[model samples]
Target: MNMSTTSTFPQTDGVMTPRRVAGAYLAEIRSECLRYLRNPGFMLPLMLFPAVFYLMFGVLMNHGHADAARYLLASYGVFGVMGPGLFGFGASLALERDGGLLTLKRALPMPPGAYLLGKMAMAMVVSGLVMVLMLLLGVFAAHVPLSGAQILGLLALGVFGVLPFCALGMFVGTLIKGQGAPGLLNLVYLPMAFLSGLWFPLSAMPSWLAAIAPVWPSYHLNIIAQRVVGLSDAPVLAHVWILLGVAVGLLWLASRRLRRHG
Candidate 1:
């Protein structure tokens, strides 16, 4: 559907229930995604983070063990995709909520799905860009070679990698205040990355630290990404399903929170 077609959404119980205006939703999604693009603040870290990890663990420090470079190249690539899902999505949602825009938007005839779908679309867009940058580093600088099929497979892995985090981000946004979102996300991001075996293998951590790895989505995502990149023996589809399950559970929790507060 083109943007020009105006569909009149019928009111249900004195409120117009938003039907999906594909074009309108797409436009809004694009606009929402563009918000980050206009500001260069987010770009620098996303572009540099993989390289930073590469340099720190891959070359200079060499703390990741023998296959550290390859392992980190894939691991950081997955983490790069996740950073946007967690940080950007949470930041935007919390800001809109505290600004009272979500309330205003809810009063409109727009579909309830639009808000969420917009977030998902924005997450996908941002994560896709982040993955591209990370992959470029892997190919050009990190000395990791990926074939055409592997690239396609990597895209699938990246998408699945972000889904659960996107759900958690939504949940986090609902729970945290706007002004505190940046700090809250950072708190969650760094700890989760460290504990979930993203920075290094679970085996390398202390026993207590290793004990917590099973509870995290990032751990599962790491294994899944490893499988996708041909680095592990785990079944790729199973982990993707597990990640989907986690996303679905978080989305449900977010729904409950939104309804309770709405």
Candidate 2:
């Protein structure tokens, strides 16, 4: 029996090598990317909605206006990054939990964190793609002038800036059933975007609305993006701290809920 088992299991001791652990993570990430890419209902809206909106408002409407193009580019980039983090985690996770996939994965022998990390990796990738699409429209279509560093900075921001929203989405996923997640997230998503001034400058909003804009993560993200693109001189350290805090706090809450509920 020992000889037969040793022949079947190469490791012999039943210990997972480091390579095996890494492969598990890579496999999970690959599966996540494939799953989302294959779902047109999910992928199309996440990828195109912001790009279309940017083309209409940032490119066509703001044609030949460099300042408008720059501002909208920064704002819309934040808007674009929000979708993947929110829907990808919030809606899909709820649906997966309903389908019993989360439980199945928990019963698997893989690392516990791999599941969430896989979703996060996919979100970051989608966020990066969305930023690329927006930057292309801003540069070629709108004729916005941005240096290489600025362009790279904005791209990096979109890729990493998605974490707080991901945490928020995770928390939301733990709160409701699958069918309700999308609608509830939309309620949070659209209003937050508008309130954060992603659609337009807060200067145009009422004084009270403008005063409270800083409460939104998107607002702080927009400030950092604006600073990166040279549209604003706002100090970035405070905004960075705020976003970090939001991400950490929401993630802690979500993990607790997932443990208790899932």
**C-alpha lDDT values of all predictions:** 0.77, 0.90
List model 1 lDDT by residue over 1-262, tens digit each.
6655587654555643245456668777887778777777876675577668866776567653546666776788777877878876777778888998889988876655877887787777777777776677667766676788877777766665787888888889889867899789889888988898888878899999899787888888888777767778867677777888999999999889988985
Candidate 2 residues lying further than 4 Å off, grouped into runs, are 1-14
List TM-score per model, in order.
0.86, 0.95
Can you list the residue pairs that collide in candidate 1? 18-111
- What is the C-alpha lDDT profile of model 2 across 1-262, one tens digit per residue? 4447444655456577899989999999999988887888988898788888888988777647788889998998999999999999999889999999999998888786999999999999989989998899888888888999999998999899999999999989999977999999999998999999999899989999999998889999999999999988979999999999999999999999999989
- The top-ranked prediction according to TM-score is 2
User: Candidate 2: how large is its RMSD?
Assistant: 2.3
The number of the candidate with the highest lDDT is 2
Global Cα lDDT for candidate 2: 0.90
Worst 10 residues of 2 by lDDT: 1-10
